[model samples]
Target: AGVDDGSRLRLRGEGEAGPPGSQPGDLYIFIRVAPDEIFQRQEYDVYCRLNLSFSQAALGADIEVPLLNNESKIIKVKAATQSGEMMRITGAGIPHVRGNGRGDQIIQMMVETPKKLNKKQKAIFQELAEIEGNPIKETLKGFFQKLKR
Candidate 1:
């Protein structure tokens, strides 16, 4: 029940029979743990990714994350959360291989931008762009300055 990948078990005299007067060889078995579809393990730590809509990321929301079992937990994503951010849940990962405590679960946040917009959506975005001015122009200016240096 406590076994993990790479664990070996040796069975004495469980191999093929040898000569009449000699002892049989031992049988060694290696353990191989199959990969789970959702979670990825590193040592005792587990990791997964969560996708967030642009509005959800900008306005904050409570999202559900899956556990090792068939359960889930809700985590709060703070407002203005950026893409590629990481959220860690302490003691929510896999149990230690041979210890009393468990590890942590790390979730990577991915913010998705819409690919297609309706007429009203496009109008709203254009208004926002107007209010925000031209960020691309400022970014390009910074890039050119860096290149000149």
Candidate 2:
């Protein structure tokens, strides 16, 4: 009989062959990695949201924030001089690939006021309101005049 070289050849006269002349071939396998939620695989950068307190936003403070490895870290954030300011914490984002550099952490400043003010607080605010003297209207008028020119 003509048998190909790649095919298995059985010899009836083979000695010490598992009692009845049996054979086994080698096996091969491949594996793949699954996506992870905690770790984001990216080339460039990663972003996340960070909340701040009223006092924290008013006066710059160092506060602890949560990270991936269940560890807390204190990141110093500069206080917002004006309302609606954003603070960026550099190189505090997700891990990067081997060749590329790491990402950054963006912390947005949100001024949160108290729901109910105490009597002393209200009185202080009233005094401040009286002292400010409608600066917003004057500022807007100046801005519009500058825009016209």
Candidate 3:
């Protein structure tokens, strides 16, 4: 039931029949697979992107990812996981159409920063920024000054 796109199949005697005593023609079928919403197929491999919150990326957590077979699996995200980091689920991808084994699922992590923070959250971030010395702001300021000069 999981035939890949652009696959071809032939059924003998399934097409239009010849004259009364002649044999029927062979029917050829070309397969075309529809695009999935969550997963993308590359050969036998599957890939998808999972979004993580800032805290989740900074701190480790167990996350659920959907499978191609309508099931979900838990993945352990390591602490300080950065954006664009990839995690692999072995044997969780598309199966080889003509072989016996399956491919792997490659998940790319995307860390999403908070767009709006409450007062308490802002205060905490402010404290953290001060503790970290807010180097990013200074770096950008210095770059802009250099450009102006």
lDDT, model 2, position 130: 71
In angstroms, the error of model 1 at 42 is 0.5
Candidate with top lDDT is 3
As for candidate 1, its clashing pairs are none
- lDDT tens digits by residue: candidate 3, 4-35: 78999999999999999999999999999899
Q: Rate the local accuracy (lDDT) of all candidates.
A: 0.87, 0.56, 0.89
Q: By lDDT, highest first, what's the ranking?
A: 3, 1, 2
Worst lDDT run of 10 residues, candidate 3, spans 133-142
- What lDDT does model 2 reach? 0.56
List the candidate 1 regions with Cα displacement exceeding 4 Å. 1-7, 135-149
Q: In every candidate, how many clashes are there? A: 0, 0, 0
Q: What TM-score would every model get versus the actual structure? A: 0.77, 0.48, 0.80
List model 2 lDDT by residue over 1-149, tens digit each: 11222344344434343534565433333333354444333333333445666667767788776554477678776766344565555666655545455566554445667789899977766677678874323576788999998
Q: Looking at model 1, which ten-residue stretch has the lowest summed lDDT?
A: 133-142
Per-residue lDDT over 44-67 for candidate 1, one digit per residue giving the tens place of the 0 to 100 score: 888999999888899999999898
